[model samples]
Target: MVTALIVLYFISAITNSKKIVILSGVVFSFLLYPETFFIICAISLLVKILSTYVIIKDLYIALTVLVLILLKNTFFSTASGYQLVGVSFALFQVCYYIKDNISCGDLISKLSFFPQLYCGPIVKPSSFDRLKKINIKSLALYHLIFAIGLFFKIYVAYVTHKIFLEDNSLLNSVFWLAYMYSDYLSWSLMGIGIAGLAGFKMPMSFRAPFFCRNVSQFYSRWNITVFKWCNDFFKVSGSKKYRKYKAYINIIVSVSVLSLWHGLTFNFLSFGIFNITYFLIQNKIKKYRKILLISQILFYFLVGYTFNGIIPNYIFPTISYKYGILFIVSLVTLFLFDFFFYRKVKKIISISPPLVIAVSLIFVTISFFVRHIDGQFYYAQF
Candidate 1:
């Protein structure tokens, strides 16, 4: 009986094109019952359709709904509930983007069952639409690519969890941070590669990001799509009069938004704060290119060592800080090594099909193992 009412409420919300009403219903249901997130997501789809023709106007409304949901969860719900609220808001953002006249074909082309659900490398509607019109032969080739991608997503990310992660500790925390970098790198590569194989041209998350000599370059190489999106939508370009300050502003806003999107956890906020400080410092000394490079390397190292393995859990026992230090250290070390020694990494891989396959396999193995242990889709919680 409760399920039916929830369904009917969503239907009513969408039919009326009233996001506030829909969000209100969702909040009430979640607060009282906590089993309505799924139903809320279903209703969100309907809202997606209803707003298609009036996207510019509705986007703000949708954002408002998300804010309300987050507020309600933060103030009244459990930690799990807060996470769920974050996920719901993330989904709503996607829905709003889709409602902005994104083609069905583009939507299909961008679909990656796992990544699309959780933390995403958020695709632009324009790019998604363009990819949808590819011919069948290309799509067939893409399917083969997608299969390989799926393997990495499942196997590589999953299997490597134990190798890179450990319980909360200073050393373990650093390791986990480093592990997360690699894990995210592998998962993102697989997700984007699969999308590409499906005949969609997607922006990459890491394009030799670790080798970048400075924060600005780091942003360009890491999560390219997210950076581009912020550039476009947030108008993060430096103004002629405020050119010096622009980079700092852009970095702060972009990192903050990215952190929030990860989930409204304290750890996520800390991560963003740390990144923003790093970027700000890096940007100030950018003119001294060599110094900038060295600083970035040191920054990565510190972040890796400090944030990696599972220190957060120990530091704040109420929170899960698995693999905190180790993860951070690994990423920093990898970045430093790649920048200083493996400059030709991209060039070599770009030309080697066999090498690509092997790397893809490794990533798949890690993803599969991680998923098995975590018992949750990494991106699904987005």
Candidate 2:
């Protein structure tokens, strides 16, 4: 499949960019691995056929591809197959978007490749392309930084998983949460490294996302690139005419797309609904000024635990009415609380050298101890 794509890319690059060659390349790849490539080709073909018949925009095509991929994975594939399809679709989407020049979708599709494909600090294409033009020295330095980030993701998260994930004790939950945090941080750092290596300017996604005072702020900082993309391409931007309502719509669409992108599993949908509800409530609180600081902690714990539980169960039964109900309930509760309360601001502490060393040592020690038990890094699969 990779070889076919490379050949096709070379042909397309040198030739007059005929659609036939492009389509043929895709077909060749599909034929090489029917189980995986077929679906990818079918979706791309659908987009191409649809684009010819209907004047549907590129963004819609991109969305369609994502939706179809999710559905295919959710309904058809085994666990490994599902990941393979999901990652393949993601990669294909990026490549197609880059070649087609389909407005913001094109740029975003390219930007979504590295960091976004993995743990996702999804970026916009324009910004990404700009970075790609940077000098070689900067790129090398960025790769080094990314390597360090990869070490933590592989080591620290692995250790935490071994210590807690396999044991299934109460402490396991705490360790799991800690592991998740580390996972997010490690991935984000890796993203920064990639962006730097690619020479793309760092968008405002990672500057203090962890220390955000509120859920909304946290999301804004955590994956500013995705947030920006959704706003630009998904047409969910804020406006005075319907700023509040628009914010809610953006939250829903963005979260839903995120869920679907994870592959069309019930757990992914649940996670999406969970986050949407959380964000909706967070937005409502902005108007009411009613923040529940403690609830923030509770919300994260509840959602995380529920998601963890649902994922294993979801693998066996991709669709479950009970899971759906639970998902809706979780979402509803998040909005209800968000509408009714205010949360206290937590103080940020300065990172002393000793504290940093301690944290690093703990992470390294834990990672080394439990490296064997860790599954493939989620992004690495992509």
Candidate 3:
């Protein structure tokens, strides 16, 4: 699949034809996941038919979410060993196209841009309009970006994952959350790089979320595209008077639906429950920014149990002194990486030709040495 994407990118780059790039990319993705065709096509058609209705906005949003949930229960629940990557992202794009009312000739092509198909920065249709104006450039910088993501996934996250397996201690809990972020950000950066190579600019999924002053701000930066869609689904997609309801109403619905939409498993249920509680508690502590920020980070760390509990054995596992020192080092590395990423320090350094070449060689060498761990990337299963 990666080979095919590289081929598609270079062909488009050589021909200087983005239309062919976007449309043909969709065809390639369909070959990889044909089940997506019916759902995406159905949503596209529905959005086209319903686009003219103005007063039915609330009902329209409700209908779309209900349709997706129904699809989840009927089709997805019954499938065995099926890889349903990109389903939610594709759904989000069509629904956003409906709500935002953007015009695009090939909805599937816009939704399934190959780089972002599995994991996403979830760009809007309006951005596709700018493709023609973007000066085509080599992907040297983007390759370095991809290497950083690969480093996060294979080295940092994989190293940290083994430690917190069944232990749910508060400290290990936070470390597990760090590992999750490392795992998630790995492919997110990779997708962004690949999308850039494909001549599409995907937005960053996070914006210094870990260093924020509070959980509300933390959430304001994290998985922003999904949250925006969820917010509009519950809040902005309604009439003006309906929009005047309490702000938390949208927060509650947005996270709940997002939670279940992610999965029907206990992992997702707890994910939804934890986030809902986390957001609701935000109101009580708004007055204390610094203290609240610290509290929020700790609370988010506790999500280690919610999102990744193997079993309810809340005992703290003993770590050897060496592993303990290594865990602390990993935590510091995670903090510095997030900080550097937000500040674009890494971006500046990655742009050096020598560094890019060095990263490429190291990436190839690591690729040769490591067993294929792509299957273990957290979101690949989704």
Candidate 4:
């Protein structure tokens, strides 16, 4: 099977066989399907040209090309299953590559790298170069990580399926917010796992987000690579050019674009504006930083609730005893586990490889029994 071959490609790096045949097979998997390959190539070419124009400092040409790509992305949606597959990530990579003046060969290689094309932390040009070598000693650890990542994805899928099946209630909403942390965590672990076996010391896509003390900290901790990309865009967009309103403009544009990058929907737009306003207020009240952390926890919960669409009722109209108790227990447990126990848990896992692998296998086994159907990540649609 092609899947097995790809796995072997990573594992075989210990012998440094060059894996030319395996690499070709992996690339061909993307190309074998005519429709998928066509769409990927078309979008890749458009973004490549868009970046080229930007590098030449031809704003008018770049804007024109960008608009055309947007029209293709927005209007002619059928070609890409209406989801536009890798455009969001590929566009980000285009920006990074152009800014760094990467050559055509390198640009194509980076964009077409199959491992991260589906979902990504948006690898930077410098980081992408790590693909050139193999780290044989870490192979066993990488296998453990991949298993853990598999368990995480399966567990999240199972939990979310059950939670959403419940009747519309405030308690379910609270649970959903706490569970949302798993999104980036699962994807990051998978990416890191594959990167490890491939011999690349990839950067983490997330840090301890739930323990974050404020809105600023949350953004920095969650989806770190994308956050940095947006920050880079903001710095160039107007922050450096306009001294007086540097912070104000950067926050406004960055948040808006960040929301837009997620999707072209009212809910996402509102999510962005809500966070922007919250960040501004927190910034204004910097002296009360301690309170902001507590406030941020509540603010993030509301954002998670609003993230999809309007709820059935405005804030738990009349909570049932069962749901209310569940919410309280779940919220308190989440705070304690993520905030207080995280370090200790990491220490335990680090010192005991057998324990780590055993626990991961147990979770993976549990996942097989409770697995349920689910769609791709919300950001995957973008």
User: Candidates' TM-scores?
Assistant: 0.60, 0.57, 0.77, 0.72
Residue pairs that clash (backbone atoms under 3 angstroms), model 3: none
In candidate 4, what are the lDDT values of residues 200-237, reduced to their tens digit? 65567776677766677777777787777667654544
For model 3, state the Cα shift of residue 372 in Å. 3.5
Runs in model 4 lying further than 4 Å from the true structure: 1-36, 43-54, 57-81, 99-109, 131-137, 165-167, 171-173, 236-245, 314-375
Q: What TM-score would you give candidate 1 relative to the actual structure? A: 0.60
lDDT minimum window of 10 residues, candidate 2: 341-350
Model 4 residue 17 CA deviation (Å) reads: 7.7
Best by lDDT: 3
Pitting candidate 2 against candidate 3, the one with the higher lDDT is 3
On a 0 to 100 scale, what is the lDDT of residue 360 in model 3? 53
lDDT of candidate model 2 versus the reference: 0.48
lDDT of 1 by residue, 1-382 (tens): 1222223223322342223332343344455435434544554565556656454544355445446544544453444554542344334445435556545433322332233323456555544333545443343333334334344334444443554443443334434434455555545544444444433454566666766777667777776766765565555445687787776778776776566555455666677888888887876787998898788767654564422212334443122344334334444545654464236544544565455545544544454445443333343344
Scored by CA lDDT, what does every candidate get?
0.48, 0.48, 0.64, 0.56
Name the lDDT value of residue 81 in candidate 1: 53
lDDT accuracy of residue 301 in candidate 3: 58
Q: What would the per-residue lDDT of candidate 2 be over residues 19-47, giving only the tens digit for each residue? A: 34434433553454354443433444554
